[model samples]
Target: MSVLDFDNLTKRYGRTTALRELTLSIPEGSVYGLLGPNGSGKTTTLGLALGVLQPSGGTVRWFGAPATAATRRRVGALLETPNFYPYLSARQNLQIAADVKQTDARSLEAALETVGLAQRQREPVSGFSLGMKQRLAIGAALLGRPEVLVLDEPTNGLDPQGIADVRALVQRLAAEGRTVIMASHLLDEIEKVCTHVAVLHQGQLRSAGPVAASLATADRVVLGLAPGTAADVLRAALSSLPFVQDVRPETDGRVSCALAIGHSPASLNQALFAQGLALAHLEMRHRRLEDQFLELIKN
Candidate 1:
């Protein structure tokens, strides 16, 4: 059974529909990234999935059944900015949270260790940096040993080093065999950390798949031919290689083709030379995640 499933989930705040019949399934062991622009319903989906907000229509299931009071304990979430007592120490704050959640001492210890906060557990919250505070919040979410961790914009408002620290911590948590559901506008973070991605635009799903395949939508092997090289000759040469696809002539006398996954641009160039047309230039343009993200939001 999938870790989480949203079945035609829809949400409306009176006249404003936040989500529109969205359906998705998150498998076990996936670091799932929920991606979209500011108002594309990423947060709304998380909220509905966590039962923080009631959906206007549809159902959310956890581990093959509808979410219930018991099901929520299996998932942990850190949405928006976290709050802790300024005067309280990190350990104290977590102890309070643990008391509220009924988490035991062993679980709390494991949680602090997972986020690398055990060394500073006794330090006051006022002494912690933004990244440290974020880690503490994640540590709190780890209470009760939840199987799935849900984080919304977890890296927001941190310095570069802090971002790196949190990123590493997140990677470690996922390595320990926990499914992670994260919502973020940062494509780089998603690309670096997530195994699966679901993109939303205008409250609708634009695409969903493995991160590599999603970003590899149209990776091109750019071939700039020598002057006066006929486009037909290039097309004819490419025809012999079935893996070369979407062959088109550029206005500047360059020809570009989609290289099949696992095939490098060097291999494509070698294939072209073997076909007896060795002329000018060959370059590989690996499509950027941001470029793919923009295209999704644009359409």
Candidate 2:
């Protein structure tokens, strides 16, 4: 069942519209990615969904019904950098947040462990790295053990190690059976961590669905043959297959091709093997999120 639904949701600021007729559903137990470039309505969509901002038109629904304050409580979100006292320890800060949110004080211990900060519970917030700070913010969100987490750029301003840390943590959270809806401009991070993705552009949804299926729906595939084989030999084989379309050559002596809408890497491999050819290297590449985002807005 869908845990969240946006029914023709629209949000506008006077003459400028931030969202346009967004109709999307987020099922339970999904790690959903809300993606777009800056100023592409990603933040606005999250705000509307969580009731932090009112929609200009249409309804926001949670758990198959219209959203309410009680429904909002079932979701935790971090839209921006969390404010923590520089001198206060992690535990101390969360304690204050718990009281402010009126969540159970007993959640303090579980929240700390959920974000993997229990070991450093006594450390001052000032000493933590940017990634640690982000994790602490997520810990604060996790205080109520909400059924869903709405995180806007959870890995912003972090080093590579920090990015990896947060990715693993998100996966862990999903494995625990909670839904996560993350809004991020970092396409690579979203590709790595999210199971489902929705791409937005100019206040409109360009695409939405399972990440792999959406990417594979229409993608570029690169096939490299070993030194003993000529490029023409493989090209001829691929060209004969119905699933391969727009077969072309690459500068690196690889064959670049597009798969038919319903085809996949496995289908290509199976078809090639039937013709007695073993693939030395096969890589599938899709238009980058940046390129796709531009195309969405441009068209």
Off by over 4 Å in 1: 85-89, 113-132, 239-241, 250-252, 261-267
TM-score of each: 0.88, 0.79
Please give, for residues 88-109, the per-residue lDDT of candidate 2 as tens digits. Answer: 9999999988876679989999
Where is model 2 more than 4 Å wrong at Cα?
84-93, 113-133, 223-240, 249-255, 261-298
CA-only RMSD, every prediction: 2.7, 4.1
The TM-score measured for candidate 2 stands at 0.79
Best by TM-score: 1
lDDT against the true structure, per candidate, is 0.86, 0.87
lDDT of 1 by residue, 1-299 (tens): 57999999999998999899999999898899999989999999999998889999999999998898778877878887677997999999999888867778678788888778899999899988877888888889989978999998988767787688778867887899889999999899999999999999888999888898976865877787788878778878887797888987876777788877788888888888887889588877787888888988895
The prediction achieving the highest lDDT against the true structure is: 2
Q: How many backbone clashes does candidate 2 have?
A: 0
